[model samples]
Target: MSTSRFSSYQPFFFALVLAFGVFIGVMLGPIMGSKPTPTQARSTYTRMDSILAYIDNRYVDSINTDSLLDVMITNYLNDPATIDSFFKFLDPHSNYIHKEDLQGFNEDLEGNFDGIGIEFNILNDTILVVTALSGGPSEKLGIQSGDQIIRIDDTLVAGIGVTNQQVMSMLRGKKGTVVEVDIKRRGENELIPFRITRDVIPVHSVDVAYMIDDITGYIKVNKFSANTPYEFADAVIKLNSRGMKQLILDLRSNPGGYLQGAVSLADQFIPGKELIVYTEGRAVGRTEERSGKAGLFEQGKLIVLVNEGSASASEILAGALQDNHRATIVGRRSFGKGLVQEVYPLPDTSAVRLTIARYYTPSGKSIQRSYANGTDAYYDEYMQIVMNGDADSVNGRKA
Candidate 1:
């Protein structure tokens, strides 16, 4: 049986479906080391204190909360295992994506990003090719998903803890640059080397949304990007004229995107004054956003196909539509990502996307998955679900 901790994981996932096309809840850019604003500092310190206090007082066994929390933070950034296990127990949907982790997340969410264009994963400390870009250098050179990237130039990728960040740094170089990679596939025991020239990869956020039937228009939203809502609105307008009665909004693998974009889209469905979502933070006041008058849900039977991967703004849209009974949410429950991030200006012309507020659906559901032990435990639990095939039950309904 799922514990209350496990159950708490749902709200964060209400937004994501775990698609490789998915990224983090916050879109962060570069940021220089700068002191936090007074409000921001308070929020940070409060969060820090809360974690410390919990570790100090609530742990079943005696422990040092301050040191443990530090260790936990260090582990969260230094090791993915910390996040992998934490999510296993309490809010499995919460993600502990660091700044360096943004590349993969963006590539997944936007379908493409500036990179060398190779899909890789860690298997027993070896960088294995899950896949490579189609028509890209890796594929042209005969690299397959099962292939193991044993080396980068002369640097061995195995034995050492070569993280996804490290691999990305090694491979994703400036355009017109070249990266030499060595691989060993399942069939071949010998390491094969290839020099790949990097290039810009075009990302497709909107999957075809043409009329599948005279009545149903199928639009697959892979991820919510900057251009998603604009494209989505145009598609809906065209479909409306085409006599679409039933619209299948497929958010199956969508990770999420901009809040304004989601709210804009959701507003098209809900008429007015409807609470789509509300957030409260230490510095931020109760900020509530609702659908205005642009949504297309009022006209037809909207069936939003969701699963474990749909998250963030995706969850916001789904929750808003579902809470208002404007659409029939099919498939499975979403990745409940309720933590709203505030991207503050940093000294380095970058931004810090900090968790400022917890988002609540209209019915007072704190969609942000509980980060009870921070982000470490959150991710570990998610991995456990894969091993146990328990992802379907990630979100247990609360009475």
Candidate 2:
């Protein structure tokens, strides 16, 4: 059935169970290609099948399916927590986002989330500022890139196991709101205080771009968000004006996002009409994205930096560049995530991301690594790579 047609049954019980099955069992690396319609038949009738048939056949219309889900789960699984725990076994990426976290998740994907505007990392148990975003509230307050955030308001967040989410919660807020942060700067004895008035921070994919030395330019992309390609192009234009002859596109530690963003980024490097990536599945036929017009950095010498953290869209961009021989891929093996996800919002404001298609590189190799053992084993494979000293070993799989 079509996804739209299937989702239309949202008010019913079968849709919910099907969604659960999709969330946990679907594998990445194969797109659902278009197929001829099959004849509908009621073939098998088993125990679980009988339960599903009963819900579809006997459930009253006035009964709320949402509430029914809760009741059924409470009876079968004892609680919704069990369902959440079990669904994770399906895939490493496929999971449900509760209604409370959906807004934050969407904000990240949309490429604009309100904050003081600083990209940070926990280095040595300290919130080290990777970069104070250009034209952001923190940048306006003279917060430099190397500054460390030791405290938010009165809380000493440093060296206290404060997580990224915790810091984000403290920093992010509505526009016109003020946040106070204590900074630790090099060659400074006392902590520097800054009262930053929060605003709509443009969460850029191209985090920072600067001319290295005389002719080499560097651009670090944090994620492949909605506006990544445009942002990257704008950065390239600025560097081009500054006599940039070579480019280093950094995708290190960038967990990928939108697929279109990766294709657009690859388009900027590869010249002429060239195939970038393709998707094929049982339900979704062969769909290929090719480079169109001349790209912004087509003439420049390019280098793409990827590591174990580079994944999904990151792998797509790297794979495209690698297959076309457009740029030298330097660093470790990318996080293999060849599957595509389509987020569907539920009636209760919660959302579930279903793995829809497996993507392939220009050379027609699957980007996803093996997940046959389970989600934990799939993730552990990377750790095994690290332990086996194979991080620098280029396995030449194309994908």
Candidate 3:
């Protein structure tokens, strides 16, 4: 009777076990053989992804994804105060360049742009031409200094509260573009209508290089650019030909640019493989720059002038010269800006200028001032010198 009962339940038990096995196989098949898609393989889902997804699904109105992303990035990268606590630490100089502004920013560093080149000042609600740049379309068209711009193209600009940006927008265009302007000269009563063609205008870094006395030459460097080295060399040659035995490099109020330009300028004074500057960072290890070639004006009595406005590459050059004992640094103390920025281009043609390294002079001294109190305080401290009349003091020291 026991054997008979067992045989009767055996078929029912076998069927139940088979059903469970089928369910397990069905559940595990996909997991065992599945492969991640390209997007999944590239990056895991982040908080940003979650936020964007939530916004897409639950937001009240339609949103442009591209513009939204742009705004998010711009706000976070351009303004440190807007960032979260986790990402609050950012230097003032490290900034983001939008795609639209990238071209102009690059042109500034490259030392050239396509425009009717004329430096202008808005005075008494009128656009006054300070001076037409040399060899530019405006200068070639006989646009003189002190000429008042009455109109740009068809737009009446005079007495209209036109901004500097508006004037630049009106004057700058693609090469071969024509921009008409009406100018009122000091003597001439009639408005001089001139049609200027836009062309590549060279931005000169060396503002002026001339002999102050018989033996002393003066060179005012406005900023370091890609063309700075060549321009400086030319200036040196010109001064040398004119009997210059000593040099006064005026870097006062010069906001600096281009590390290479500063290094090259320092090389012009430092002799024979001596260290000019060295940089160290987490990503870009230790790197040293030294004088490698014969330099112009190397034998001269060199002097570099700096003020509170002189910074970045200006500081680098001054520090290099001072550390090498190659030049005497005169005037007020330099605006300490020894952080080295490296521009990284993004996929959208925008860029991020990140402070990648801190540069040191030959003596391994960093000229970067303390910014621990924040950027606002950092700038305010420098500005206080003027208010306290400390700027008038020799060597920026309070008497």
The count of backbone overlaps in candidate 2 is 16
Instruction: Quote each prediction's TM-score.
Output: 0.61, 0.65, 0.62
Give the distance in Å from residue 238's predicted Cα in candidate 1 to where it truly belongs.
Answer: 4.1
Q: In candidate 3, how many clashes are counted?
A: 0
1-399 per-residue lDDT for model 2 (tens digits)? 235533544455576577555422321113212221222113433344334434444567544444555566568763445656655545666777766657767776675777888766665578877567667888888997567789899999999998656777899889999889999988899999999999988766777899996999999997888988788999999999999999999998677889999999898889999999998755777789999978888987889999887888999999999999999999988788898888998777888887767889999999888766777787666656533443321111000
Off by over 4 Å in 1: 1-113, 116-155, 173-198, 345-351, 385-399
lDDT of each: 0.64, 0.74, 0.74
Ranked by TM-score, the better of candidates 2 and 3 is: 2
Candidate 3 achieves a global lDDT of: 0.74
Task: Specify the highest-TM-score model's number.
Answer: 2
Candidate 1 lDDT over 1-399, as tens digits, reads 124443566655553333111211111112212334556545543554434444444558977544554465566645546544443443334335555565455556445555566555565577756445555567677776556678887798886988877787888767788888887765676877788887776555566779988899888775666777777888888888898998888887466767777787788777767889888765676889876675665768888888776778878888888998888889886777777765454343333455656777788887666556755666565546433433222221000
| Clash tally, candidates in order | 47, 16, 0
Candidate order by decreasing TM-score:
2, 3, 1
lDDT of 3 by residue, 116-152 (tens): 8876666568876756766788888898767778988
